[model samples]
Target chain A: MLEKANDWSDTFYDKWKPIAMGFVNGAEKCLQCGKCTGQCPAAAVNPSYNPRKIIYDLVNGNIKRVLSSVELWQCFFCSGCFATCPVDINFPFFVFMLRLGAMSQGFGWEDVKQLEKYAEKDYLQDGITVSPEERNPYVIEERGDIADIRQKAGMPRQREVSDEAIAEINMISDLSGMTNFMKKIGGVELYDCSKCTPKIEEKCKSKELPKKVGNVKTHYRFYNYGVPIGGADNA
Target chain B: MHKLDKLSGIREEIVADIPIPEEIFYFQSCVASNKYPGIESCTLDVLNKLGVKPFVSEDQTCCGGFVTFANVAAPTASMPAVARNISLAEEEGLDICAVCNGCWTFLNEFGHFMNGNDEVKESVNMMLNMMGREYKGESNIFHIGAMLYKLKDRIAENVERPLEGLKFATHYGCHYLGGGKYGAIDDAQHPSFIQELVEIMGGENVDYTASGECCGTGFTQVINDKEKSLDHSQMKLESVRDEADPDFVIVLCPYCLSQLDRMQQQLDYRRDVKLDIPIIHITQLAGLALGLPKERLAFDAHIGGQDRFKKALNKIGIDY
Candidate 1:
């Protein structure tokens, strides 16, 4: 609802013309219906991501201002925006495009340094991901299935991403083009995550795997259909 | 494993002269082509028995999805190639379908860029124009999943040898749904097309609830390379095997099938789950139901089906 601004700085316009124009075109057609804003789970938790507002900023050639806002990064890409839009406009895809656009133009990734570490380094080691022993109440509450699977896998439990593995992922990340982009534009520290090999060798001591991880459920003993499926009680 | 779901296995009659198509185009998937040739043949055989002909465009490459999601390449790179391929189908007046979810999804990218993003279309067309190929952007690109759905009636009717007592779960890969703006049919989370097709074929579509989840077949190794013990790749098949409780798992995408079937060995070895769900492609199922020869059904390559299909063939009036 800020005052209409037809004008954009020459520097910002030239840098993000494609991105800024795409957003503006996308937003002006957004219908102001609040479908995307409404369905955004993040919006439910935090009101700052007015999909309407984000689109509004983009439509007006406000690339710098739009990218600078923290609200842009919070979108979950859940497609709630697409489901709710009457025009069937896919706002989440647009938001993703906008984010890529912002990153390409060098305005958005203020906190990309932590992310860059993963992109730059590699560590090859073999160890259980983390000992399950150090897990806290949060682990019990949030990832109970994973925790249970970790235990069942006969894995020593440590919920934290191991220090060694973290170092390795950074090794791998730095080898990619993504790291260079992050380094130049968004000022994100790019890591070399692809190179972490020693850690992988360390973890080569095989252990039981979780029965279910993400969507895949690995049944170890038998395929019984009559019994109640595992984890039916989860959210 | 072979459990029937319907009252009668008999198929409805249709005009014999729809003239099953040939010169068919198969969309090559980054994951499937890389991992499983077994599934690729099964899909082809299924198409063949339905009297349809197929041709693999070997010159065809990855559907540009590796860069699409990351948003690195301009739409021009993808759209023109797709538009040119689609134009070939239109020239043949044939439907172009890819078995892998990602390739099928990129087909939608071609559709959207041509109809929605004119500038992107122009750029793509310009490049293709350089290649002495023209892209008109009118052909329909389908995932084998959608084609199976479109051929549902034909499928039900062609059950010369029905998979009478088979219970299976469905795995609808992510790319198939969100392929592009105009690329999808049903809800991405809970698609019923495969399930319905199972029922039409006289096989029971079991309750494998996590049907829409990513099989972790694509990009899983790259992303999870750091944490070897993490078993992140296991998520693709493990979740469905545990929940669906089906005797066998079915997939339209070869990548999903490979992860489900090949990873079965991994899960059995690594997790000791002994999960042995044989993954079959929809086209294979259709071919079986249509009474294609057992060998014609491409049963040899697809894992976990020889014994089950033998039992099924014993009970049905099969032609092949």
Candidate 2:
């Protein structure tokens, strides 16, 4: 069901190198520490996700393996993994990169497909799945039930951002190469997080995926603390 | 941790485990009396535990907050009306505790307004003068959430039972975690203060992603609209069910409790996804683990009932 190794003939090339640098910069808080691996609840349970190992992979230039690996999705992104890092490294953010990378290179569709379920239904009206960004802001402003209560208490009704605003926001997200890459790799529809299950594989497969968000290129940091290249793309 | 230390008082009661106020003023909310009485009962239960002795007074109406927060009535009318209520509390010489965030915010901000806006303050204090009541500009008013957090150490210290491994996530709601003007005991972004209370009592703090989102039960906003009303409530429920699925969800506000507990089940089928997460007042969960029976504790009144919290109660017993 999952793809194995793809052919890599220095496929990364010079084109993506500059864009990938932005990920390194955005990940400026990252310290080459293995602490995230030590503390991650998912990593604790699943030996497959060693954050340090992914960090090592990024440095190894193993973008292919990072592109296809399911390891990135396991992060809980509690920020605890980043909070405790001595160098202040945030591997969870790197996890966000792999999510895009997986979708970008048409890798890890299974997990990307799964994660997309959260945003699918509300994607049309509310925009985006997961209520926030692709990476972990770790900010949850409303839960389903509490939102239910606010209506009863007369919480001020907010109009869904106007179509103009939604389009502008998506235009901005498209500008972020990583976000566009995510849509492609996961085969996610341009605007939805639902229809992510394996049964909805048709919706999960998009041929004209926008791998590049706006002008910037989207890249995956498959090796979190370890390497992102260990999955199918690099195998 | 000094801010954390400001909280952490000892638990002096058993059954209600309600915080007992040596001097408390029952600063009521507009909705609680006619709408949600459980908030009153639950607050009383918590007050009783903390050894609080609340004094209820006469002629208390809306904290003038309902319309004020809603933007219907201007601060011109709201401020003076609130100061009158504070004067009543001051006459009793008690720290005011409103079960509603609106009451707490209005009371806290009324003094803030009195000091900040001289004309408004003078007018309010002037109104108090006519009634033979001086609005004591510096009266302490707090929500039940802040009071509970303050008693964390006390909660940790006394536990007839502690709920271990019982996953819980807290919904702070807006008034508690507003734009930061009202001030909350916990971090608005990653609030674990209440979760700490659950853990201290030996309960599991469920590591859910949507712990801090709005519960969209704005009493006035969705009165007429059907779709927005459902979206408002459904979104909050969807977020909590997003991850770290738990035995139960805890809330500090009554309106939040109603939406999550009562309305959620009704709307569950309409939702794209189904959640078994039961919502309860934070204090209610505390009372359950403290060895209170279903009657005094009143978990059966909830839709999913004690079964959601029953295991946690048993776990707390084993841990203690």
List TM-scores for all candidates, in order: 0.58, 0.51
Per-residue lDDT over A1-235 for candidate 1, one digit per residue giving the tens place of the 0 to 100 score = 1112223463433344454324323345667777567645445433444677766656666566565454555454434466557777667556656655554444333323323322222111211111223223432443343333433333223223345333322332243233344344333233233543565434321223232322222222211112212221220
lDDT of 1: 0.49
Fnat of each prediction, in sequence: 0.01, 0.00
Candidate 2 regions exceeding 4 Å error are A1-235, B1-21, B30-36, B269-273, B300-320
| Model 1 docking tier (incorrect/acceptable/medium/high) | incorrect
Over B113-226, each residue of candidate 2 has an lDDT whose tens digit, in order, gives: 576657656765665565455665655677777676676666665566556566777776655544222245554445556766776777666555545544544433233223
Interface RMSDs of the predictions, in order, are: 14.5, 18.3
Q: In model 1, state the lDDT of residue B144.
A: 73
- Candidate 1, residue B289: Cα displacement in angstroms equals 2.8
- How much is B220 displaced in model 2, in angstroms? 2.7
Interface RMSD, Å, model 2: 18.3
lDDT of 1 by residue, B176-284 (tens): 5543433465555345666777778777766644454445443322222212211333543556557765656777766556556655555555567555566777766
